[model samples]
Target: MATRRYLQLDVFAARAGTGNPLGVVLDADGMDTASMQALAAWLNLSETVFFVPMQDPAADYRIRIFTPGSELPFAGHPSVGAAWAALDAGLVDADARALVQECGAGLLPVRVEKTADGKRTIELCTPRRQALSTPPVAIPASLQALAAADAAPVLWSNGPAWWLLRANSAGAVRAFAPDFAAIAAFTNATDATGLVIFAPEAGAGHDVVVRAFCPGDAVNVPEDPVTGSANALVAAWLAAHAALPHADGRYVASQGRELGRDGRVQLRVDADGDVWLGGEVQPVIRGSLDW
Candidate 1:
Protein backbone atom coordinates (compact mmCIF):
# COMPACT_ATOMS: atom_id res chain seq x y z
CA MET A 1 0.00 0.00 0.00
CA ALA A 2 1.33 3.42 -0.89
CA THR A 3 1.34 6.04 1.82
CA ARG A 4 -0.57 9.17 0.85
CA ARG A 5 -0.17 12.43 2.73
CA TYR A 6 -3.41 13.68 4.22
CA LEU A 7 -4.55 16.87 5.90
CA GLN A 8 -7.56 17.51 8.09
CA LEU A 9 -8.88 21.03 7.94
CA ASP A 10 -11.59 23.13 9.49
CA VAL A 11 -13.03 25.48 6.88
CA PHE A 12 -14.69 28.81 7.60
CA ALA A 13 -13.57 28.49 11.17
CA ALA A 14 -13.91 31.54 13.31
CA ARG A 15 -11.64 29.75 15.74
CA ALA A 16 -9.24 26.81 15.57
CA GLY A 17 -11.84 24.09 15.95
CA THR A 18 -15.10 25.75 15.02
CA GLY A 19 -15.97 25.06 11.41
CA ASN A 20 -16.79 22.45 8.77
CA PRO A 21 -14.27 19.63 8.67
CA LEU A 22 -12.56 18.35 5.51
CA GLY A 23 -10.16 15.55 4.68
CA VAL A 24 -7.71 16.37 1.92
CA VAL A 25 -5.60 13.82 0.09
CA LEU A 26 -2.59 15.91 -0.84
CA ASP A 27 -1.28 13.55 -3.53
CA ALA A 28 -3.90 11.28 -5.03
CA ASP A 29 -1.82 10.39 -8.04
CA GLY A 30 -2.87 6.85 -8.91
CA MET A 31 -5.88 6.30 -6.67
CA ASP A 32 -8.95 4.95 -8.43
CA THR A 33 -12.41 6.44 -8.14
CA ALA A 34 -13.86 3.59 -6.08
CA SER A 35 -10.92 3.75 -3.69
CA MET A 36 -11.38 7.48 -3.28
CA GLN A 37 -15.07 6.92 -2.59
CA ALA A 38 -14.29 4.37 0.07
CA LEU A 39 -11.66 6.66 1.53
CA ALA A 40 -14.14 9.53 1.70
CA ALA A 41 -16.66 7.27 3.41
CA TRP A 42 -14.03 6.22 5.90
CA LEU A 43 -13.18 9.83 6.63
CA ASN A 44 -16.94 10.62 6.89
CA LEU A 45 -16.56 14.36 6.60
CA SER A 46 -18.93 16.70 4.80
CA GLU A 47 -16.46 16.49 1.93
CA THR A 48 -12.87 15.70 0.95
CA VAL A 49 -10.44 16.71 -1.77
CA PHE A 50 -7.90 14.86 -3.85
CA PHE A 51 -5.29 17.05 -5.49
CA VAL A 52 -4.06 16.00 -8.92
CA PRO A 53 -1.84 17.71 -11.42
CA MET A 54 -3.60 19.86 -13.96
CA GLN A 55 -2.73 19.16 -17.58
CA ASP A 56 -3.99 22.55 -18.66
CA PRO A 57 -1.30 25.16 -18.37
CA ALA A 58 -3.80 27.78 -17.25
CA ALA A 59 -4.84 25.76 -14.23
CA ASP A 60 -2.56 25.65 -11.23
CA TYR A 61 -4.16 22.44 -9.95
CA ARG A 62 -7.05 20.01 -10.22
CA ILE A 63 -9.22 18.83 -7.34
CA ARG A 64 -11.63 15.94 -7.02
CA ILE A 65 -14.33 16.65 -4.44
CA PHE A 66 -16.20 13.87 -2.72
CA THR A 67 -18.80 13.50 -0.02
CA PRO A 68 -19.33 10.42 2.06
CA GLY A 69 -22.05 9.35 -0.31
CA SER A 70 -20.69 10.44 -3.70
CA GLU A 71 -18.40 12.68 -5.72
CA LEU A 72 -19.63 16.21 -6.21
CA PRO A 73 -19.27 18.49 -9.22
CA PHE A 74 -18.18 21.29 -6.95
CA ALA A 75 -18.27 22.23 -3.28
CA GLY A 76 -17.26 25.41 -1.46
CA HIS A 77 -15.34 24.28 1.62
CA PRO A 78 -13.23 21.77 -0.25
CA SER A 79 -12.10 24.44 -2.69
CA VAL A 80 -11.08 26.80 0.08
CA GLY A 81 -9.56 24.03 2.14
CA ALA A 82 -7.64 22.69 -0.85
CA ALA A 83 -6.34 26.14 -1.71
CA TRP A 84 -4.92 26.50 1.78
CA ALA A 85 -3.42 23.03 1.59
CA ALA A 86 -1.88 23.77 -1.80
CA LEU A 87 -0.16 26.81 -0.32
CA ASP A 88 0.68 25.06 2.94
CA ALA A 89 2.31 22.23 1.00
CA GLY A 90 4.26 24.72 -1.09
CA LEU A 91 2.58 23.35 -4.20
CA VAL A 92 2.10 26.83 -5.62
CA ASP A 93 4.00 30.09 -5.62
CA ALA A 94 3.45 31.84 -2.27
CA ASP A 95 3.30 35.25 -3.92
CA ALA A 96 0.60 34.30 -6.44
CA ARG A 97 -2.56 36.19 -5.63
CA ALA A 98 -4.79 34.25 -8.03
CA LEU A 99 -4.76 30.66 -9.14
CA VAL A 100 -7.05 28.58 -11.34
CA GLN A 101 -8.53 25.35 -10.06
CA GLU A 102 -9.89 22.74 -12.44
CA CYS A 103 -12.65 20.61 -10.99
CA GLY A 104 -15.73 18.72 -12.18
CA ALA A 105 -17.45 22.03 -12.80
CA GLY A 106 -14.57 23.32 -14.92
CA LEU A 107 -11.81 25.76 -14.10
CA LEU A 108 -12.54 28.38 -11.44
CA PRO A 109 -10.40 31.15 -10.03
CA VAL A 110 -9.32 31.38 -6.39
CA ARG A 111 -8.13 34.56 -4.70
CA VAL A 112 -5.54 34.31 -1.96
CA GLU A 113 -4.94 37.11 0.51
CA LYS A 114 -2.84 37.35 3.63
CA THR A 115 -4.03 39.60 6.38
CA ALA A 116 -1.74 41.88 8.36
CA ASP A 117 -2.06 39.50 11.32
CA GLY A 118 -0.59 36.68 9.21
CA LYS A 119 -3.92 34.92 8.68
CA ARG A 120 -4.41 33.66 5.15
CA THR A 121 -7.81 33.97 3.50
CA ILE A 122 -8.92 32.29 0.28
CA GLU A 123 -11.99 33.02 -1.81
CA LEU A 124 -13.39 31.19 -4.83
CA CYS A 125 -15.25 32.90 -7.61
CA THR A 126 -18.66 31.25 -7.87
CA PRO A 127 -19.69 29.41 -11.01
CA ARG A 128 -21.29 31.49 -13.72
CA ARG A 129 -24.75 29.99 -13.39
CA GLN A 130 -26.57 30.36 -10.08
CA ALA A 131 -29.99 28.74 -10.35
CA LEU A 132 -33.21 29.65 -8.58
CA SER A 133 -35.27 26.53 -9.03
CA THR A 134 -38.93 26.11 -8.40
CA PRO A 135 -40.24 23.69 -5.78
CA PRO A 136 -39.08 20.21 -6.66
CA VAL A 137 -41.47 17.29 -7.09
CA ALA A 138 -39.54 15.23 -4.59
CA ILE A 139 -40.97 17.04 -1.57
CA PRO A 140 -43.67 14.90 -0.08
CA ALA A 141 -47.15 16.12 -0.82
CA SER A 142 -48.23 15.76 2.79
CA LEU A 143 -45.23 17.52 4.22
CA GLN A 144 -45.77 21.01 5.49
CA ALA A 145 -43.93 23.44 3.27
CA LEU A 146 -41.39 25.48 5.17
CA ALA A 147 -40.44 28.96 4.01
CA ALA A 148 -40.61 32.55 5.17
CA ALA A 149 -43.45 34.48 3.58
CA ASP A 150 -41.02 37.19 2.59
CA ALA A 151 -38.30 34.90 1.33
CA ALA A 152 -40.38 32.10 -0.23
CA PRO A 153 -38.96 28.67 -0.99
CA VAL A 154 -36.14 28.76 -3.51
CA LEU A 155 -33.99 25.93 -4.71
CA TRP A 156 -30.62 27.54 -5.39
CA SER A 157 -27.61 26.02 -7.06
CA ASN A 158 -24.05 27.03 -7.70
CA GLY A 159 -22.99 23.50 -8.49
CA PRO A 160 -25.12 21.11 -6.44
CA ALA A 161 -28.65 22.23 -5.89
CA TRP A 162 -29.62 23.10 -2.29
CA TRP A 163 -33.12 23.93 -1.15
CA LEU A 164 -32.48 27.46 0.15
CA LEU A 165 -35.30 28.59 2.41
CA ARG A 166 -35.67 31.31 4.99
CA ALA A 167 -37.01 31.63 8.50
CA ASN A 168 -38.38 34.71 10.16
CA SER A 169 -35.38 35.35 12.38
CA ALA A 170 -32.03 33.94 13.36
CA GLY A 171 -33.61 32.35 16.39
CA ALA A 172 -36.03 30.38 14.24
CA VAL A 173 -33.28 29.27 11.94
CA ARG A 174 -31.19 27.97 14.82
CA ALA A 175 -34.21 26.48 16.55
CA PHE A 176 -35.57 24.70 13.48
CA ALA A 177 -36.22 21.00 13.96
CA PRO A 178 -36.60 18.98 10.77
CA ASP A 179 -38.29 15.70 10.03
CA PHE A 180 -35.46 13.67 8.57
CA ALA A 181 -37.76 11.05 7.10
CA ALA A 182 -39.45 13.57 4.85
CA ILE A 183 -36.12 15.06 3.93
CA ALA A 184 -34.83 11.62 3.06
CA ALA A 185 -37.79 11.04 0.83
CA PHE A 186 -37.22 14.35 -0.86
CA THR A 187 -33.56 13.74 -1.57
CA ASN A 188 -34.20 10.26 -2.91
CA ALA A 189 -36.61 11.62 -5.46
CA THR A 190 -34.55 14.59 -6.57
CA ASP A 191 -30.96 15.20 -7.58
CA ALA A 192 -30.73 18.15 -5.19
CA THR A 193 -28.14 17.93 -2.43
CA GLY A 194 -29.85 19.30 0.73
CA LEU A 195 -31.45 22.19 2.51
CA VAL A 196 -29.92 25.52 3.61
CA ILE A 197 -31.96 27.84 5.76
CA PHE A 198 -31.14 31.34 6.93
CA ALA A 199 -32.53 34.40 8.67
CA PRO A 200 -31.49 37.95 9.43
CA GLU A 201 -28.79 38.06 12.07
CA ALA A 202 -28.63 39.96 15.31
CA GLY A 203 -25.87 42.18 16.70
CA ALA A 204 -23.54 43.87 14.25
CA GLY A 205 -20.87 41.81 12.57
CA HIS A 206 -23.00 39.49 10.41
CA ASP A 207 -25.97 40.10 8.17
CA VAL A 208 -27.44 36.58 8.20
CA VAL A 209 -27.38 33.31 10.12
CA VAL A 210 -27.36 29.96 8.29
CA ARG A 211 -27.91 26.24 8.87
CA ALA A 212 -27.59 23.40 6.30
CA PHE A 213 -29.11 19.91 6.46
CA CYS A 214 -28.80 16.90 4.16
CA PRO A 215 -31.00 13.86 4.67
CA GLY A 216 -29.55 10.43 4.14
CA ASP A 217 -29.91 9.26 0.56
CA ALA A 218 -27.77 11.09 -1.93
CA VAL A 219 -25.83 12.42 1.07
CA ASN A 220 -26.15 11.42 4.72
CA VAL A 221 -25.12 14.51 6.67
CA PRO A 222 -28.00 15.74 8.77
CA GLU A 223 -26.66 19.18 9.53
CA ASP A 224 -23.72 20.97 7.99
CA PRO A 225 -22.00 23.55 10.18
CA VAL A 226 -20.75 25.84 7.45
CA THR A 227 -21.45 25.58 3.73
CA GLY A 228 -19.79 27.74 1.04
CA SER A 229 -22.06 27.10 -1.94
CA ALA A 230 -25.22 27.42 0.09
CA ASN A 231 -24.14 30.79 1.40
CA ALA A 232 -23.44 31.97 -2.14
CA LEU A 233 -26.98 31.07 -3.07
CA VAL A 234 -28.19 32.86 0.06
CA ALA A 235 -26.21 35.92 -0.94
CA ALA A 236 -27.73 35.85 -4.41
CA TRP A 237 -31.23 35.50 -2.98
CA LEU A 238 -30.62 38.32 -0.52
CA ALA A 239 -29.17 40.51 -3.21
CA ALA A 240 -32.23 39.97 -5.39
CA HIS A 241 -34.69 40.69 -2.58
CA ALA A 242 -32.63 43.45 -1.04
CA ALA A 243 -32.99 41.49 2.18
CA LEU A 244 -29.46 42.27 3.30
CA PRO A 245 -27.77 45.44 2.34
CA HIS A 246 -24.42 44.84 0.73
CA ALA A 247 -22.38 47.93 1.18
CA ASP A 248 -19.60 47.62 -1.40
CA GLY A 249 -21.07 44.23 -2.32
CA ARG A 250 -19.58 42.56 0.73
CA TYR A 251 -21.47 40.75 3.48
CA VAL A 252 -20.65 38.49 6.40
CA ALA A 253 -22.57 35.25 6.99
CA SER A 254 -22.81 33.50 10.36
CA GLN A 255 -23.29 29.73 10.38
CA GLY A 256 -22.66 26.47 12.32
CA ARG A 257 -23.54 27.84 15.76
CA GLU A 258 -26.32 25.28 16.17
CA LEU A 259 -23.78 22.47 15.92
CA GLY A 260 -21.41 24.24 18.33
CA ARG A 261 -19.38 25.54 15.43
CA ASP A 262 -18.54 29.21 15.08
CA GLY A 263 -18.19 29.64 11.32
CA ARG A 264 -18.04 32.89 9.43
CA VAL A 265 -18.41 32.93 5.60
CA GLN A 266 -17.43 36.08 3.77
CA LEU A 267 -19.30 36.95 0.58
CA ARG A 268 -18.51 39.52 -2.07
CA VAL A 269 -20.93 40.50 -4.83
CA ASP A 270 -19.05 42.00 -7.73
CA ALA A 271 -20.58 44.80 -9.73
CA ASP A 272 -21.16 42.26 -12.49
CA GLY A 273 -23.35 40.19 -10.13
CA ASP A 274 -20.64 37.68 -9.43
CA VAL A 275 -20.68 36.20 -5.92
CA TRP A 276 -17.42 35.24 -4.25
CA LEU A 277 -17.30 33.23 -1.02
CA GLY A 278 -14.28 33.12 1.26
CA GLY A 279 -13.05 32.57 4.81
CA GLU A 280 -10.08 31.42 6.87
CA VAL A 281 -9.28 27.74 7.23
CA GLN A 282 -7.79 26.26 10.40
CA PRO A 283 -5.47 23.29 10.00
CA VAL A 284 -6.39 21.02 12.85
CA ILE A 285 -4.98 17.58 11.96
CA ARG A 286 -2.16 16.46 9.67
CA GLY A 287 -1.07 12.91 9.00
CA SER A 288 -0.66 10.25 6.31
CA LEU A 289 -3.19 7.84 4.80
CA ASP A 290 -1.99 4.29 4.52
CA TRP A 291 -4.42 2.80 2.03
Candidate 2:
Protein backbone atom coordinates (compact mmCIF):
# COMPACT_ATOMS: atom_id res chain seq x y z
CA MET A 1 0.00 0.00 0.00
CA ALA A 2 1.13 3.53 -0.81
CA THR A 3 0.87 6.09 2.00
CA ARG A 4 -0.48 9.58 1.38
CA ARG A 5 -0.17 12.56 3.72
CA TYR A 6 -2.67 15.36 4.36
CA LEU A 7 -3.18 18.38 6.58
CA GLN A 8 -6.31 19.28 8.52
CA LEU A 9 -7.44 22.80 9.30
CA ASP A 10 -10.51 24.78 10.33
CA VAL A 11 -11.42 27.67 8.04
CA PHE A 12 -13.55 30.90 8.07
CA ALA A 13 -13.04 31.25 11.80
CA ALA A 14 -11.37 33.49 14.27
CA ARG A 15 -10.49 30.57 16.52
CA ALA A 16 -10.36 26.82 16.56
CA GLY A 17 -13.63 24.80 16.79
CA THR A 18 -15.59 27.73 15.40
CA GLY A 19 -15.47 27.29 11.62
CA ASN A 20 -15.75 24.78 8.77
CA PRO A 21 -13.16 22.06 8.81
CA LEU A 22 -11.30 20.73 5.75
CA GLY A 23 -8.91 17.91 4.93
CA VAL A 24 -6.16 18.94 2.51
CA VAL A 25 -4.21 16.34 0.60
CA LEU A 26 -0.88 18.08 0.16
CA ASP A 27 0.50 15.98 -2.71
CA ALA A 28 -2.26 14.49 -4.81
CA ASP A 29 -0.38 14.48 -8.07
CA GLY A 30 -1.25 10.89 -8.86
CA MET A 31 -4.56 10.26 -7.10
CA ASP A 32 -7.52 9.38 -9.35
CA THR A 33 -11.13 10.56 -9.09
CA ALA A 34 -12.49 7.31 -7.65
CA SER A 35 -9.71 7.38 -5.10
CA MET A 36 -10.53 10.96 -4.16
CA GLN A 37 -14.22 10.18 -3.65
CA ALA A 38 -13.43 7.18 -1.50
CA LEU A 39 -10.95 9.30 0.42
CA ALA A 40 -13.53 12.01 1.00
CA ALA A 41 -15.95 9.45 2.37
CA TRP A 42 -13.24 8.23 4.68
CA LEU A 43 -12.63 11.74 6.00
CA ASN A 44 -16.38 12.27 6.54
CA LEU A 45 -16.02 16.05 6.66
CA SER A 46 -17.92 18.63 4.63
CA GLU A 47 -15.06 18.81 2.06
CA THR A 48 -11.66 17.42 1.21
CA VAL A 49 -8.98 19.20 -0.83
CA PHE A 50 -6.32 17.73 -3.08
CA PHE A 51 -3.46 19.81 -4.41
CA VAL A 52 -1.72 18.88 -7.65
CA PRO A 53 1.40 20.95 -8.12
CA MET A 54 1.49 22.36 -11.58
CA GLN A 55 4.56 22.11 -13.76
CA ASP A 56 3.62 25.05 -15.91
CA PRO A 57 5.09 28.35 -14.85
CA ALA A 58 1.94 30.26 -15.74
CA ALA A 59 -0.18 28.23 -13.36
CA ASP A 60 0.07 28.47 -9.59
CA TYR A 61 -1.41 25.02 -9.00
CA ARG A 62 -4.50 22.79 -9.35
CA ILE A 63 -7.02 21.70 -6.74
CA ARG A 64 -9.68 19.03 -6.58
CA ILE A 65 -12.59 19.36 -4.14
CA PHE A 66 -14.74 16.43 -3.14
CA THR A 67 -17.63 15.79 -0.84
CA PRO A 68 -18.37 12.28 0.33
CA GLY A 69 -20.62 11.71 -2.64
CA SER A 70 -18.83 13.39 -5.54
CA GLU A 71 -16.34 15.97 -6.72
CA LEU A 72 -17.14 19.68 -6.93
CA PRO A 73 -15.79 22.26 -9.33
CA PHE A 74 -15.40 24.89 -6.65
CA ALA A 75 -16.15 25.54 -3.00
CA GLY A 76 -15.46 28.67 -0.91
CA HIS A 77 -14.10 27.44 2.41
CA PRO A 78 -11.90 24.76 0.90
CA SER A 79 -10.42 27.28 -1.51
CA VAL A 80 -9.33 29.55 1.30
CA GLY A 81 -8.09 26.71 3.48
CA ALA A 82 -6.27 25.07 0.56
CA ALA A 83 -4.50 28.25 -0.47
CA TRP A 84 -3.38 28.84 3.07
CA ALA A 85 -2.13 25.29 3.19
CA ALA A 86 -0.18 25.77 -0.03
CA LEU A 87 1.42 28.91 1.30
CA ASP A 88 2.29 27.17 4.54
CA ALA A 89 3.81 24.32 2.58
CA GLY A 90 5.88 26.79 0.52
CA LEU A 91 4.37 25.44 -2.67
CA VAL A 92 4.15 28.91 -4.17
CA ASP A 93 6.62 31.74 -4.00
CA ALA A 94 5.99 34.66 -1.63
CA ASP A 95 5.82 37.15 -4.47
CA ALA A 96 3.15 35.14 -6.20
CA ARG A 97 0.22 37.44 -5.49
CA ALA A 98 -2.21 35.55 -7.72
CA LEU A 99 -2.72 31.81 -8.02
CA VAL A 100 -4.47 30.13 -10.92
CA GLN A 101 -6.16 26.96 -9.75
CA GLU A 102 -7.42 24.50 -12.35
CA CYS A 103 -10.33 22.54 -11.01
CA GLY A 104 -13.13 20.45 -12.46
CA ALA A 105 -15.25 23.52 -13.14
CA GLY A 106 -12.52 25.57 -14.82
CA LEU A 107 -9.53 27.71 -14.11
CA LEU A 108 -10.09 30.30 -11.39
CA PRO A 109 -7.73 32.75 -9.79
CA VAL A 110 -7.04 32.65 -6.10
CA ARG A 111 -5.80 36.11 -5.16
CA VAL A 112 -3.41 36.30 -2.27
CA GLU A 113 -2.42 39.12 0.06
CA LYS A 114 0.27 38.99 2.67
CA THR A 115 -0.79 39.55 6.27
CA ALA A 116 1.38 40.84 9.10
CA ASP A 117 1.67 37.32 10.49
CA GLY A 118 3.53 36.38 7.28
CA LYS A 119 0.55 34.34 6.12
CA ARG A 120 -1.17 34.95 2.82
CA THR A 121 -4.92 35.62 2.65
CA ILE A 122 -6.89 34.09 -0.19
CA GLU A 123 -9.87 35.44 -2.17
CA LEU A 124 -11.38 33.49 -5.06
CA CYS A 125 -13.10 34.83 -8.17
CA THR A 126 -16.84 34.27 -8.09
CA PRO A 127 -18.51 32.68 -11.10
CA ARG A 128 -19.54 35.19 -13.74
CA ARG A 129 -23.14 34.06 -14.05
CA GLN A 130 -24.41 34.32 -10.49
CA ALA A 131 -28.19 34.03 -10.52
CA LEU A 132 -30.68 36.59 -9.22
CA SER A 133 -33.89 34.83 -8.21
CA THR A 134 -36.76 36.35 -6.24
CA PRO A 135 -39.44 34.33 -4.54
CA PRO A 136 -43.01 34.47 -5.80
CA VAL A 137 -45.46 37.00 -4.39
CA ALA A 138 -46.69 34.26 -2.14
CA ILE A 139 -44.33 31.68 -0.68
CA PRO A 140 -44.04 28.69 -2.97
CA ALA A 141 -46.10 25.66 -1.99
CA SER A 142 -43.00 23.56 -2.41
CA LEU A 143 -41.09 25.42 0.30
CA GLN A 144 -44.02 25.65 2.74
CA ALA A 145 -42.44 22.92 4.81
CA LEU A 146 -39.69 25.33 5.77
CA ALA A 147 -40.11 26.97 9.16
CA ALA A 148 -40.95 30.56 8.21
CA ALA A 149 -43.23 31.59 5.41
CA ASP A 150 -43.33 35.33 6.07
CA ALA A 151 -39.65 35.85 5.21
CA ALA A 152 -38.78 36.85 1.68
CA PRO A 153 -36.52 34.56 -0.41
CA VAL A 154 -33.69 35.87 -2.56
CA LEU A 155 -31.52 33.52 -4.57
CA TRP A 156 -27.97 33.97 -5.86
CA SER A 157 -24.73 32.08 -6.36
CA ASN A 158 -20.94 32.50 -6.62
CA GLY A 159 -20.15 29.27 -8.42
CA PRO A 160 -22.11 27.19 -10.89
CA ALA A 161 -22.73 24.53 -8.25
CA TRP A 162 -24.87 26.10 -5.47
CA TRP A 163 -27.81 28.51 -5.27
CA LEU A 164 -27.91 30.55 -2.06
CA LEU A 165 -31.14 31.86 -0.61
CA ARG A 166 -31.32 34.72 1.84
CA ALA A 167 -34.38 34.81 4.10
CA ASN A 168 -35.82 37.68 6.08
CA SER A 169 -34.98 37.09 9.76
CA ALA A 170 -32.74 35.10 12.10
CA GLY A 171 -35.68 33.32 13.72
CA ALA A 172 -36.82 32.25 10.28
CA VAL A 173 -33.43 30.78 9.58
CA ARG A 174 -33.14 29.00 12.93
CA ALA A 175 -36.60 27.57 12.78
CA PHE A 176 -35.97 25.74 9.52
CA ALA A 177 -37.06 22.15 10.10
CA PRO A 178 -36.70 20.59 6.71
CA ASP A 179 -37.92 17.23 5.45
CA PHE A 180 -34.80 15.75 3.90
CA ALA A 181 -36.67 13.42 1.59
CA ALA A 182 -38.83 16.29 0.40
CA ILE A 183 -35.90 18.68 0.16
CA ALA A 184 -33.91 16.15 -1.85
CA ALA A 185 -36.87 15.59 -4.11
CA PHE A 186 -37.19 19.33 -4.56
CA THR A 187 -33.51 19.68 -5.34
CA ASN A 188 -33.72 17.05 -8.04
CA ALA A 189 -36.94 18.59 -9.27
CA THR A 190 -35.41 22.05 -9.58
CA ASP A 191 -31.80 21.00 -10.38
CA ALA A 192 -30.51 22.73 -7.26
CA THR A 193 -28.35 20.88 -4.75
CA GLY A 194 -27.81 23.36 -1.88
CA LEU A 195 -29.75 26.16 -0.15
CA VAL A 196 -28.60 28.91 2.22
CA ILE A 197 -31.14 30.95 4.15
CA PHE A 198 -30.25 34.02 6.16
CA ALA A 199 -31.70 37.00 8.02
CA PRO A 200 -30.65 40.52 8.89
CA GLU A 201 -29.25 41.14 12.33
CA ALA A 202 -31.83 42.46 14.76
CA GLY A 203 -29.37 44.81 16.43
CA ALA A 204 -26.62 47.20 15.50
CA GLY A 205 -22.95 46.25 15.27
CA HIS A 206 -23.72 43.18 13.14
CA ASP A 207 -24.24 43.01 9.42
CA VAL A 208 -26.04 39.75 8.48
CA VAL A 209 -26.55 36.29 9.91
CA VAL A 210 -27.02 33.16 7.79
CA ARG A 211 -27.34 29.35 7.70
CA ALA A 212 -26.22 26.95 4.93
CA PHE A 213 -27.60 23.51 4.09
CA CYS A 214 -26.54 21.05 1.41
CA PRO A 215 -29.11 18.25 1.03
CA GLY A 216 -27.57 16.25 -1.78
CA ASP A 217 -25.25 14.45 0.63
CA ALA A 218 -26.38 11.91 3.17
CA VAL A 219 -28.07 13.02 6.39
CA ASN A 220 -28.99 16.22 4.45
CA VAL A 221 -28.12 18.57 7.32
CA PRO A 222 -27.08 22.20 7.52
CA GLU A 223 -23.46 22.90 8.16
CA ASP A 224 -22.32 23.76 11.66
CA PRO A 225 -19.77 26.27 10.29
CA VAL A 226 -19.95 27.80 6.83
CA THR A 227 -17.36 30.06 5.26
CA GLY A 228 -17.84 33.66 4.10
CA SER A 229 -17.11 33.40 0.38
CA ALA A 230 -20.59 32.19 -0.59
CA ASN A 231 -22.13 34.85 1.60
CA ALA A 232 -19.85 37.46 0.04
CA LEU A 233 -21.12 36.48 -3.36
CA VAL A 234 -24.71 36.76 -2.15
CA ALA A 235 -23.95 40.16 -0.63
CA ALA A 236 -22.41 41.34 -3.87
CA TRP A 237 -25.45 40.18 -5.75
CA LEU A 238 -27.77 41.96 -3.30
CA ALA A 239 -25.79 45.20 -3.44
CA ALA A 240 -25.86 45.14 -7.21
CA HIS A 241 -29.59 44.48 -7.53
CA ALA A 242 -31.20 45.91 -4.37
CA ALA A 243 -29.04 49.04 -4.15
CA LEU A 244 -28.21 48.21 -0.57
CA PRO A 245 -26.10 50.83 1.18
CA HIS A 246 -22.61 50.11 2.44
CA ALA A 247 -22.11 47.64 -0.36
CA ASP A 248 -18.62 48.96 -0.65
CA GLY A 249 -17.98 48.97 3.07
CA ARG A 250 -16.50 46.04 4.94
CA TYR A 251 -19.24 43.74 6.25
CA VAL A 252 -19.40 41.23 9.08
CA ALA A 253 -21.34 37.97 8.86
CA SER A 254 -22.38 35.65 11.70
CA GLN A 255 -22.98 31.98 10.87
CA GLY A 256 -23.49 28.62 12.58
CA ARG A 257 -25.31 30.23 15.50
CA GLU A 258 -28.09 27.69 15.21
CA LEU A 259 -25.60 24.86 15.69
CA GLY A 260 -23.84 26.38 18.77
CA ARG A 261 -20.52 26.73 16.89
CA ASP A 262 -20.95 30.40 16.06
CA GLY A 263 -18.47 31.86 13.54
CA ARG A 264 -17.60 35.34 12.32
CA VAL A 265 -16.60 36.14 8.72
CA GLN A 266 -15.40 39.43 7.25
CA LEU A 267 -16.12 40.61 3.75
CA ARG A 268 -15.17 43.46 1.44
CA VAL A 269 -16.46 44.13 -2.06
CA ASP A 270 -14.12 46.22 -4.11
CA ALA A 271 -14.98 48.83 -6.70
CA ASP A 272 -13.54 46.55 -9.36
CA GLY A 273 -16.40 44.12 -8.64
CA ASP A 274 -14.22 41.71 -6.75
CA VAL A 275 -15.48 40.29 -3.46
CA TRP A 276 -13.19 39.32 -0.59
CA LEU A 277 -14.00 37.06 2.36
CA GLY A 278 -11.45 36.98 5.15
CA GLY A 279 -11.11 34.79 8.24
CA GLU A 280 -8.52 33.06 10.41
CA VAL A 281 -7.81 29.33 10.60
CA GLN A 282 -6.11 26.84 12.91
CA PRO A 283 -4.75 23.31 12.54
CA VAL A 284 -6.57 20.66 14.53
CA ILE A 285 -5.46 17.13 13.42
CA ARG A 286 -2.91 15.65 11.01
CA GLY A 287 -2.61 12.16 9.55
CA SER A 288 -1.83 10.05 6.47
CA LEU A 289 -3.85 7.85 4.10
CA ASP A 290 -3.11 4.50 2.47
CA TRP A 291 -4.03 3.82 -1.12
Task: Give the clash count for model 2.
Answer: 0
In model 2, residue pairs whose N, Cα or C atoms come closer than 3 Å (at least 3 residues apart or on different chains), thus clashing, are none
**Each prediction's RMSD to truth:** 1.9, 3.6
How far does residue 117 in candidate 2 sit from its true spot (Å)? 4.2
TM-score, cand. 1 vs. native: 0.94
* Candidate 1 Cα misplacement greater than 4 A, ranges: 132-146
Alpha carbon lDDT of each predicted model: 0.83, 0.67
Q: Compare the candidates by lDDT and give the number of the best one.
A: 1
lDDT (Cα, tens digit) per residue for candidate 2, span 52-132: 766556567778888776677777778778778877777877577887766665666777777787755567665453665
lDDT of 1: 0.83
- Which candidate should be chosen as best, given TM-score against the real structure? 1
Please give, for residues 130-154, the per-residue lDDT of candidate 1 as tens digits: 6654644755432234566666566
